[model samples]
Target: MSAPGPSESGSTTRRGAAFADIRRRQQATRGRGRRTRSLFGMMRPYRGRIAILLVALLVATAASLAPAPLAAKAVDDGLSKGNLDHLTVLVAVLLGVSLVGLVATVVRDRLVGWLGARLLSDLRERIFRHLLQMPVSYHERQRAGVLVSRMTNDVDALQTMISSSLVTLISSVLMLLGSIVILISLDLKLALITFTTIPVLLLGSLAFRLASVDAFARTRETIGAITAHLQETLSGVRVIRSYGREQGHLDRFHELGDENRRANMKTVYLNAAYFPAVEYLSTAAIVIVLLVGGAEAIDGAVTIGVLIGFVTALDNFFGPITELSNVYTTFQSGMAALEKIGALLDQESTLTDPAHPRELPDPLRGELRFEHVTFGYGVPSRGGSASAGGTGASSSPIVLHDIDLTIPAGATVALVGSTGAGKSTLVKLAARFIDPSEGRVLLDGVDLRDLRQRELRSRMGIVPQEGFLFSGTVAENIAFGRDGATREDVERVVASLGAGDVLDQLPQGLDTEVGERGGSLSAGQRQLVAFARALIAGAPANGDGRLGGPSILLLDEATANVDLRTERRIEEALELLLSDRTAIVIAHRLSTIRSADLIAVVEHGRICEAGTHEELLVRGGAYAKLHEDWQRGTTDAPSAAAS
Candidate 1:
């Protein structure tokens, strides 16, 4: 296969960079809608719990208000009247009310915590479910690290608001309202004087909210940026070290961290300015009330008890105002989080299940067909390769255009091409990982688009060029191929593939940890394990003839990343697995090239040659040229390896 020119590689890099920038801007600049609606929408499912919580808050508020009035009664009706019995009774009532308020507070908090936890759980699950339904194209266009940040940091901010900040907000509003009502009843003149500062408080709050909203939005963006940078850098740490680019990566990380710091500083500055101003206004209100109420008490216009009660109400009022300043900050942060998370939830996936899907046949014949298929990334412009991670760099708009091909049931067909010939895209079509933009892929005479994805995919087995494994034991990774697969089933598949020898070499055999992405294993070992996983997922049934495994196999250069010995083992395993199944294999090696039952040579989004190996050789066309090149490379490999 010829290598891409400098222009093609440069274009790919530029396109990838441009695409990433566009995505980040979209995430950052999404419309800022009212968070209350989104928050309530999530809480709607727990309406019963919310109603109960509100009732508890109301009870608590009422109980808290009881003490101020009782103090007044103790002063005016008991102490002033020299009635010891009344004073004692009033004190007892105040104590009882306080205790009831405490109990109610505890109950309210518990309910709030429960509701918050449940909402977070539901939100996380909903995001994950939606993501699962999204098409491969959507994920390809996104950065996994950014998505992780959305799922973690962004969601966590909202969770914090729910679990802790919400209680403060509710308590402040309730206290503020209760304080105002009681102050009016105690002494209307004094209450009106105290309420004079209300406008200042309102204005300050509004200003803070407006200023802090954008600050917190930037904070969220910086957080995502830093997280994405860290994840990307660490995932490629080995590459950085090998290339001696650690300092360059460190500088980049420092830049991201610095941006995060600056964003946080903006919120800090806003809080510093807003909170102190609120406190000053609150204190000013208190002093004026103290001065005016003292004059009224001295002149005998108001009772000492009434003045004292009014002063207490004044404290309650200003206290909540100060508390609400803090709550406003938290709310702004939560709102920022909601905007980011809401954007993610609003993303529409291109791939969707048909309203009414046709059921596939019970015993699938596994025949595969592509009819006049065409596809592009998103725009008309196209350049993508069939190779893993290759975006075919084409000056034209089409990637795969009007290509036609078929693989008969129980036949082994190999696709051979240059790096960007759309072989992998063809394989993806067979797996229905993506839909063709202009044509149809059929399985057993039924259009793939008409079949349910889950049922259709369940009957097919695919192993991509890259073998990805999760963090788990070797046995667990293998068993992941099929749900509910047992240790015995794993062992049986291993034994059949003669993979027991590989397992025996591990320190803990089947229990050996694969680490993240099977990092604990060599490339060859990982491939072997992946192959075993595929085998077990599609293992043949018992003697009763009931189908247990997949009927179709799609292998995209399964041996591309392994050593010669490993490749031989994989080929041997493939021989047994492919004997009774329809198979489509993407070939890069000469050995794979010669062994295929039918070799299809793809060129520029079309099949330029198709025939048996011997027949193609006799024709002396593209296949013949590819065959000669393979032979020449095989001859030179030994010398190249020795040097």
Candidate 2:
């Protein structure tokens, strides 16, 4: 081709951009179609009730439409002809129609309410199950408030649509269509005149739709933001009050609330101007038809009864329109909510159980091995020498590099390093909380991925920095670690952990409620309970203290916050806890891990030293440096922090 001018180049570029935009829009449309199908597919199980609802709607609409014709018959065939008997018959038929309509409406409401409740329940369960299934990395990047919003605010929008707007939409369409046929059949001329206002209605709706294109979606978004803010505030109220930042948090919450209010107001503004105008137009159509029909009657071209019937039937046309207008808010919000919920449902977890999961070997040794593994959160990482940020296709820094290590069965391996040195990442790999990006983690001889997550988790127990307890008795919280664990089982596990004082300290012993997140108890108490919870799962079946349920125990060093006395008590419990179990502890204090079977010095996603603490001290490498720093800092040795 000859050298093209800048104008030609610009034009070609514009065309290409335009085509790309078209493709994006097409893709979005297809996505929405799929989401819509998924939303309705949730209702498939209740199709039988749906059929009954449909029948009720039809019956109700038919009964509702019968009245106008009956009035016309009474006027033309009964009143005008002076037949009282005929008028009486029409009146009785009218009463019968009202009764049928009443019954149908009741059935419709009952079924709609039932479906609304069922769908809302199912939607929450789906979101919750999927959310729990997601890998630790996915949760690490997402806000708790946003996920809570999906389960609460987004799902509630659909509830409003089901209970209110759904029936209106169906009934209005049927009524509108039914009215048109009756009006045309009654008086074609008058029906055509009444139809003249439809263009105005359509034009108004088009304008409203254009103005409110993304308004409903914006409303949903703002509400979710508000919910997120509120949730965070409530969760951190103690911190806020402690820091004297309650006013600041209140200001932030108000800002979010205002944003939500503004978003909702946009839709309100559109409806305020649009729906009333429709009502006025409906009234105008009535005036036009009545004026024309009166003249026709005076000219003897139409009967008075037909004129009356046309006016009464006029509502059938505008009534559905008004009903739809009334429920438009619910419709739009529900659709917006459906899209959000669908996106959540579409989140495919990388940590799902295998299609054909391998059975866990009986007498599992829990020998953990990481073989040349690599990992990233699929999350953008902060820059520096540590993260190796902007790596590969992900553009997110790798948190773990090619690593090979083995923790033999029934060994206590203490992970020691700096804050971002992939200490927690290693234990997480061993637990299979996340899959390795490049290589595999094996339990015994089998890849972790091959084992079902539930079975794997049941065999292993993790106790983090905070031992989060549910709102229940201390015994109940301990019982959660194992299935069908009785009150006796709970008491025995506590006694075995040497944590009997925790129950004695409680007013009701094991029956005393933990309160939300174990808030009713002290930090040390919570930690002791957590230890018991972990051990109760496959605890010593006999008095000999042999491992039963949980063979692998992951501890994040729960004694860091307590006093020396409590710390010593926890250390005593840890001794018993670590017996015959494969243990990986993220050691915060260097002194605690000196006696560990193995100590791995991790630095910037690589283990620089592996051996006993004494071996590393003799070698005089990275671990020696950490030990030196800890000795200088304090006797507690928190300066040797990991993760």
Candidate 3:
């Protein structure tokens, strides 16, 4: 077997020989405890349907066994005696048995198909819900493409195995077992001859399964990696084109694809070598039966009818043996996929609500506070692995240290700092995207950890730095934050934010389609739409036609990506979204910081300066130095109209 990569390996492992031995034991124990049990647990919900399907399979097997014996009876009781009426009656009996078997086969297939579809639907829903509830830090550390592959490609492989191999294995085993018993009953000596070659087929099947387990596992891993690479490439296509790296990406993709091809080919070659060996053994068994049974029949030791029946029974037995080997390949692949999926399910979300969650008081005041907050990306101890729920180095380095800040009701607080200065991280904490490693974040005098996440988040509005939009109409995207929002509500928010000009530029206004991730809209248009979405979300109602969203707004670089003209439009929209709410803005542009009610200059996870923009400028602190740089840049560029 190929060695495990950094990612397929466990979260913790040891390197030295003694430690490696311990690690292996731990992994084996874990596998024995949960892997197989989880796989069977997935099937438990469909046990009733599976039971009915098995009954159909057994009936089909009994019908199939009847035809061989009836043929024997026809030759012995009618053909040999020259009784024309008996022959006709025996032939008619065979036809009835065949028809019954055909119907049973159809019923079995329908049951299998239905069960497979239901299991797949349930599995997909379970995985998606689990992933959605995982801490945001888990997603931040994972590749988008890898996660998508787990949801799509891995699940598809599992579905194929469940729908085909599982049914085939059960039916084939029943047919093989029933045929062997009938063969022994028909002619003892001929059955003994058939049993001699059965050992060879069983041994070959075992060998084939062992070899295929590793081959299919490798194939699954390679496909997941290739999918992840492709997803990353597609998402960054603009960067590749701008940097003239198209050929480089194509070459890398081809390399990964070639690896996948080789892995699959290995499985193909194993099957090629295995199935023919089974066919050879099966044919050899028939030849032995012919040689032994023919002599015995001619010597008056066995009847011709019994000889013919034994040969037919042998064929039925070995055919299933060969088919069973083929099913083994799929079984191995399904097990491999289950292992990966189980690992994902085993991951525990680091953040969860208290057992008895406390609710905020009726009518929240939109106040937020950070009490001695300190956060980092990793574990505190030496050699301890950090949770996948976090990103960056394994060794924890403090990002925010002893931060105690509070924003009163309906205040705007802007965070300003250089890149990597923890501005974004602080904003994320306010939204409880990631909790502080040390200290507590409270909303309206209550700890955030004590409140249910959905309840807390639903009462606040958050606009991310990227301004991502789903594939939908302009109106749909705007109303996404507030379920059941009316057309009038969307229009009022649009006009209130001065985003009507953006609608005029669109092809169909509110009905215009935004491509995937809002690709069809300009960066500025997406920002304005996101702003309007935030504004309309959680709006308070006065029983009239007016509804306003949550009283708190979190803006993370709201104007980071837009051009100057687009930035002005977003700034105008932002003014309305931020009005009458507690606003925390992560600033990238100088204009945003300049207009803040309070500005806190962040440096290496600590607030080095805090005051009004002018107060900091007059103090000549870190904020003053940053303002000086901004003024110098403005002097070097042409002035534009303000929002």
Candidate 4:
């Protein structure tokens, strides 16, 4: 995009500043719309109801003003001329109009309230649906509390504007206009005096509104901060207790509470001054009207009933103005929330599915290849860091360089390395989580990037070092990879993985709740669940002619957490699962690595040794040293555990 010009940029900045002002004013008004445009936008969906309500409001206004005229007529044509018949008829007409106005007002309130609620529901659902569709990275950067606020408080603020503020604003303006017209008709000079305080009222309202806007915005920010603090503290409450830091956490929480309190007090202070100031101006207008109109009425320039009607109309007019002022706070808060939500919606995901995706053919033969693949974690280089200026140790470097490898279909390969070996990074590259900075990863001679990510991921199974589980039943966790899978399907998978006995031993069999993050399950059980999930996911579809399933199975330290006995059971299941599939196991145990068709010892970002177990042992280089270290560690583990 071309850079904006000074005038264009300046105008944009000015517009932003104006919006900021509006946001502040909106917070002050508390869902009251500063701009008619925003208010109308919210009301647009309920235009029909609003139209009906408007008509009713007009009827009510007309009916209400009608009584004043009848009252005046009752005095002039009945009591003044000693006509009791005229007086009774006029009194009864005034009473009938009052009843009609009351009914109309009630109906108008109901219609507006219903419309406001419906609009709020629709807006909230739209925002939530959009949020669900957003990519993972978008969620990673945003605060949970802020998102909740948008869905709740922000939507609620809009509701207030829709239900009451908007209608009152319109009706008030109409009432004020009608009153002005009636006052003018009665006597021009007196009418001018009544309206003289209007400019001052408007100025005071605008100033207070702007100040209140700032106050409300601060209040909202403080509230959001408090929410975030509380959420974080609760989430890590266990850690806090373990560290004996409860008092420290309480102090921090108190600080946040105090900040929130101060912000609220500031808003309350502004509101206190604002309403009274507006009321004082209204009082001044009333005084002016009475003083000027009293003299006119006494001189017979205006009648007593006309003067009385004008004061009543003026009182009615000021009610809407007061309501409008009250709504400013809610309006400010909603606008501020909108700006935040809008920013989230505008964020573009770095990773996106292609516009026209090419699907991978089924019965995918897992032939993998890496061609001169040089990659990095995309970590920014800082001065004097070992990875900087290519001055790092040969055993550790910034990037994986010129990696060339190929794994034939249905082969089992093991990758072995120490810490900082870039082993996990290599697997991530193979999974296509991150694209290579240079070269490419190929699956069955086709560049992995050419295939749809969804299709690619579905065809492969991954078991991470730490098996993460959601809050659900054991059976639900197992069946997660395959949506709409039946209980029979889950049972079969559990049986196939030899975890049937484990499931039967649970408190409620497969129906037992796993607790959040499978807290109720042991680490070994969690691993087994992940293993079963992977096995079930890799199994062939019912219609497929092929016996064994997934093209590739990527196991990243899959058996690390399990005991030797459990590992042996897992290995047995792995053999069955890997019978006709290519398997790349990031081996943490010598027993697992020894069984592989090929073993590659990765050091730094390159393969230092590659061979079968027997071949690597005979070679006695990096592989032999690693095997020796593993044997020694295994020997020492029993002693350490016993101690």
- List model 4 lDDT by residue over 1-643, tens digit each: 9999999999999999999988975664553333334545756777788788888999887886675556667777887789998899888888889899999989888887788788778777877877765544356557777677667766776677667766777777777777677767766776777677778878987787666656666766776777777777776787999999999988988998898798778878888988888888888888878887888888988777777777776776676677667777666665655554454444443334566766665567788898888765432222222211122344433568778989888888899989778787678777776556567789988877677777787777788998889999999998886656668777777777788887688899998999988889888889998987776675554554223335788899999998777788888877786878888899768787687888988998899889999999999999999999988887789843563
Model 1 lDDT tens row, 98-165: 88888988899899889988998998998899888877767876788888898899889998888878
RMSD of each: 7.6, 4.3, 5.1, 7.5
Model 3: colliding residue pairs: 538-549, 538-550, 539-548, 539-549, 540-548
TM-score of every candidate relative to the true structure? 0.89, 0.92, 0.91, 0.79
Instruction: Please state the error at residue 242 of candidate 2 in Å.
Output: 1.7
Clashing pairs in 1: 383-391, 383-392, 383-393, 383-394, 384-391, 384-392, 385-392
Count clashes in each candidate, considering only residues at least 3 apart in sequence or on different chains: 7, 2, 5, 19
Candidate number with the higher TM-score (1 or 4): 1
| TM-score head-to-head 3 vs 4, winner | 3
The best candidate in terms of TM-score: 2
Off by over 4 Å in 4: 1-107, 367-456, 538-557, 560-564, 582-632, 639-643
How well is each residue in 179-272 modelled by candidate 3, as lDDT tens digits?
A: 9889888987788878888678778877887677678878888888999999999989999999999999999999999999999999999999
lDDT for each candidate structure:
0.81, 0.83, 0.83, 0.75
TM-score of 3: 0.91
lDDT of 3 at 228: 94
Which ranges of candidate 1 are over 4 A from the true structure?
1-35, 379-396, 544-548, 639-643
Shift in Å, residue 30, candidate 3: 5.8
Predict model 1's lDDT versus the native.
0.81
